[model samples]
Target: METVAITPLDTAAGAEQSHDPLRRQQAVVALGRRAVAAPDSEILLHDAAALIADMVGTDRFLVAESDPNGGQLTLQLVTRQRYGGNKPLVHHVALDGAQSLAGYVLQVGHPVAAEHLAADRRFQDRFLSRHGIQSALAVPLCLPHRSFGALAACSSHERIFDAGDLLFAETVAHVVTTAVARCRVEQALATERRLSAGMLQTVGAIVLVLDARGQIVHINEACQRLTGFSLDEIRRRPVWDVLPVAEELDLFKSIFDGLRHGLGPVQFESCLLTKHSERRRVAWTYNTVCDAQGEIESILATGIDITEQQKRQQPEETPDANTPAGNPPSEPEERNRQHPNAADSRKVPVRRPSPINVERRSRPRRSYPYRQSIAPVQDGELPDPAEFYQVQCNDIAAGGFSFLSPRPPESASIVVALGTPPSLTYLHAQIAHVTRMRKEGKWVYLVGCSYTGRAFY
Candidate 1:
């Protein structure tokens, strides 16, 4: 039997040659080598089928793969010369276990060779007649310890594919099985790496990585925008050197201590020194990012700017009127009255009522409580001590009245005129509740004096 590699035949001749034995085994080995050397499975399938077709003088080839569970075979690639043109047609058939040569190969592990399928009775001929195929060859593509389906070649002519063709087809089939398995593994690994990178890029919060010496090692896009500094410039720069010296040293110490003690996600407020020469108060959450061996590789931090928040929480200071322009002022009038002096007593003396009048006023009488009233305070003006008014009284509690004053006075001294307002004004009076006024808008300062021999209301 002549080898297909050296057989002499017409270019268009095709007839069943199943009984013809293999003559050029070396040529079939070369085809298997080419399939393995191809970069991917698709190329391996295409070249493997083409090589066998050339040696057998056949025109159609179908490469199939076995299912992972060993229950079925899948037709992966099919090649044919359509309309006898120079361009060949390739079809990717779907995997089906019902109506194809791949399905038959999966059920029967041996090869199938048919010469004139329309008359052959050993195999199902109806499927071959439907596809206009007259002769066919199906060889199993097997790997070590696994079956990877079969290679099926057919011809439109009455006869083709001999023993030598099936041998070459089986060799290429084995190589395609190995190539497909390897490609699937590499692709899965590449997909996992891409997904990991995508997750890191979209992580929430401003991620900043700093080295042990307080130098920036890495920063995400959010951190870069917040600090107004390019990552390149901030990298390897100390954190404290960037901030102002006025801040407390305890804040920096706490940050480093928390990181060193294996504490997770420490939170604290501090000032962030910006590239534009501005200091921004910020609250930071930090954690130590460690390597696979549990050693700290860098410090990971998240920061929130709180300068405006701190300013809003502070209270305003009270102003003074005694100071000249550009100089710090002295205390106000209310504060000055808290101190005592001899001249204050020489200004106003205590007031006393007659004993006979006090006895008559104290006589029992059923009547409504006497309504005491306070005077209104002058706007933007402090009251003079000399303007205080009084009436003679024995029941001092009922004599208590209200007076209007803005911002309660710091202190009050009750002076008694022993005889009369103009003549005995130089006498001194007993002191009363110093500052019992409610502190609010233009309110009254209520002062009650202790007049020992005074009359009742």
Candidate 2:
């Protein structure tokens, strides 16, 4: 019997040809572990390339990822053996011509093995001949949903890749594809979270996110500024605790209850108690956040501060009662006469003046007869005092004056008085309150008025 010696090339060929199931299984398991251990897609691709180069006995390995639109392939990871050592390279390339091995694998959605890349007329690529790559194997990183890219192993030696190499490359590609898909989903979720955070912080209105129990989960920068409480201070605390208004808390709870019952968004005005104990009026709109199963997960509250706006809109005081009689009414008086309902009815509280105070008021009493025009609520227009019925002036004050009329004046009625002793003057007044009393066996109405603006003199 003659004993034959095996050369290094023969040993290499024998290793490639061997049908060792355990060795193949171990290699597949190692690649799967590497995929799992990698933190991101780029790192995963780099590790996968190095693993393929070592296991397939190739001098170079490359991972080319296709663009999402499928028109291009970018070289994401490349591991090549050099004289000094094996160094990894990364770059991007556009796949235009259909003859490249990576392009062919991606287009056909299958694996391709070339024993001689330069000689293969099916695919003409000068890069292969220039880089001394004689043999190569490429498999598409295909998943059920979409194809990501292609993985290829190339050798400088001739006829290095075979059917066994193709199968091994395909297995590794499948493992890497799953890992890449996971990383992509994670990256998308992370990006969405960042965008949401940025919007919450930059939006003009105060924003607060609360759990089902009304505990604050998140508060934006606007909310912090409006409430004067930092997010760290209020987080996990009940939203009502910061509000500090018992009446508003009850209203807020009712609104949240409505949300739990699947009601539409609730909008209302309330006051927010600041850290310094100052009360600031705010208008808020609340919406509910639901989970997949339609359960209430969180509540989103957006609010705007209206304190300064309300202050700027307060009614101006009437001019001094001694204003001359001939002048026109002030601007606010004119405006109130034009649009009586412009003042917010919800904010203005009506109070009845004491009968004793009206009778014995400290202000001077004028019994002299004065003709005045009374604007009818129906048309909001004031007819001339001479055409309408005449009324007696009872008393006067710097802020307002009282008059006697046969009937009770309508609420929000505009009174314009032109008198002589008070000097020529026109007054714009609103009927603030009315008192009825019996005087000289006749039912007379005492009309208490407040000057809404400066009396024109």
Against the unseen true structure, what C-alpha lDDT does each candidate score?
Answer: 0.47, 0.61
lDDT of 2 at 65: 79
lDDT of 2 by residue, 1-457 (tens): 1111212223555455443556777867977886777556765665565556665666676778778787677763343433223334445556644547777777677778888788886667555556677888878887766778887777778865667767877788889899888877775676457437634643799888888888998988888887889999999998888774654565566556656655435555566899888899776767666644676667787787877775665421221132223433356664454335335211111232223324333334344345554443323445455534456766555345656777644334454655544453455565554444557986565665555543333
Q: Lowest-scoring 10 consecutive residues by lDDT in candidate 1? A: 316-325
Candidate 1: regions farther than 4 A off: 1-23, 64-98, 119-128, 142-149, 160-162, 193-457
Best by lDDT: 2
Q: Extract clashing residue pairs from model 2.
A: 319-454, 319-455, 324-424, 324-425, 325-423, 325-424, 325-425, 326-424, 326-425
Q: Across residues 227-303, which tens digit of lDDT does each residue of candidate 1 receive?
A: 78887887787655544234434345545664664544455445576667677766566666564456665676666
Give the Å error, residue 294, model 1. 36
Summing lDDT over every window of 10 consecutive residues in candidate 2, give the lowest-scoring window: 1-10
Error of 2 at 209 (Å): 19
TM-score to true structure, per model: 0.34, 0.41
lDDT at 51 for candidate 1?
A: 51
Q: State the displacement of the C-alpha of residue 37, model 2, in Å, after optimal TM-score superposition.
A: 3.1
